[model samples]
Target: MPKVTEAYRRKKQLEIAHAAKKVFETKGYTDTSMNDIMLEANIARGTLYSYFDSIEQVFLEVLAIVDNHSFTFIEEVCNMKFVDQLNTLIYKEVVDLLRQPSLVQARAEYFFSLEDTTFFEQRHKRVIEGITNFLQQGVESGEFAPQKDVRSIAHFMLSFVDGLMLNTSQLGETSNFVYDQLEVFHSSLYYLLGVEN
Candidate 1:
């Protein structure tokens, strides 16, 4: 038998997670099962378990993919001009959420519908910390004046995003609505940060 390298293993795991994302998006969390993911991934139960112990674990990995991408973009933007960084943050965080495909929204809604929020709560906390760091950097660089606590501002921004997600998920694929919401969020953030036009 050929030996599997760590890179190969990680690639296979990501493939499984991608398949599970499709299943969860289509069938939803409550309706999706290990069997569904197995069928989607074309893997045996043992093979699936070798990668993920449970469907929730797979879902968490899927969420991590999206969050990681966003965070990476935010990190890049942190090095840009302050106004550009601020605009990109709204674009990535707010507009992107609104523009996500309906199936992706369905997957997000599944997690929101769940009573246990520990998974999402932790993710939200991490996001807040990252946003706080970015805002602090802006304040230190004279892009933003020292005003309210950066942590508090981060929390508020996160709350706005959470509300936008809930609202957009319900609206489905309405581009106009998404743009309108994006404008509102952009304006709100610019004003909150006291950025000059």
Candidate 2:
């Protein structure tokens, strides 16, 4: 038998995580099990256990994959103007939520099922920090002059977006509802950033 290389291990892990993502998206967090993941990945029980100890661990890996993709997207748009970058990010997020409502449901269910929300809280904090840094960059470059503290604005923006996503997921998009809300959000964002629209 050949020894598994580190690269091989990583590739297998990603394959498994992607498979688990599909299962979670379909069945949600509460209903998904390790057996489901194993079947989805088409791996033996022992093979799956060797890579992941629990369903939560597999879910975390899936989240990591998503975060990596998001970071890569952010890096790709780093050179764009701050306003354009913001618009692109918002558009991508909205489209993703609308297109993958099951993913949104899974994520919400996973977080709600957690007994200790420290992980979710930490992730949320990091997101707010990232947004704050982006807002600060805009200010430093003379593109924005926020009416409030950058961090506060970042937190508020994140909260508002979260609420919008949840509402859109539950209520379903009807009669251009999402676009109308997004238009309002964009207008409010510009006002908060003290930028002319």
Candidate 3:
């Protein structure tokens, strides 16, 4: 048998992950099975099992890929003006949620289905930390004058955005509800940051 190089293994794993992502997006976490992923990847059951022990493991890989992509945006926008960075981040998030409603559904379903929320909690902690650091930079630069602790503000901001996405996913976008709420959210942020709109 030919030795499987590490690079080849990694490439195959990513291919399976990408295929599983599509299955999750279409069927959500609860409905997706190993067979679904196998069919999506066009691989035999043994091949799928070689890379992942279970569906949850594959989903975790997909989430890791997503988290990496998200942080890449943060790095890319690090040099932008403080307000511009925040605006761009929030706009991109909202736009992505709108464009991939199924992705939102899949994520929500997966997290909700988990008996232990440690993974979700840890992920949120990292996101809040990133946001806090970004906000702290604005504070240090005299661009933002947050009335409350930056960490607290960051937590609230994350919660608000998560809630907004959940609601939009469940209730459906109607009468420009997302834009209306987004406008309100932006106004609230300006007030909280003591920045002129």
The candidate that achieves the highest TM-score relative to the unseen native structure: 2
Clashes of 2: 0
Off by over 4 Å in 3: none
Off by over 4 Å in 1: 1-3, 102-117, 173-176
Task: Give every collision pair in model 1.
Answer: none
| Candidate 1 structure quality by residue, lDDT tens digits, 62-173 | 8888778777887776659877887776776566666654345545656668798887778878889888988888888888764477798889887877777767666654
Model 3 earns a TM-score of 0.92
Per-candidate count of clashing residue pairs (backbone under 3 Å):
0, 0, 0
Q: Taking the tens digit of each residue's C-alpha lDDT, what string does model 2 give over 19-96?
A: 999998889888999999999999999999999999989999998887777667767888999988878877776567
For model 2, what is the C-alpha lDDT against the true structure? 0.85
Give the per-residue Cα lDDT of candidate 3 at 53. Answer: 98
lDDT of each: 0.77, 0.85, 0.86
lDDT of 2 at 103: 68
Please give each candidate's TM-score. 0.83, 0.93, 0.92
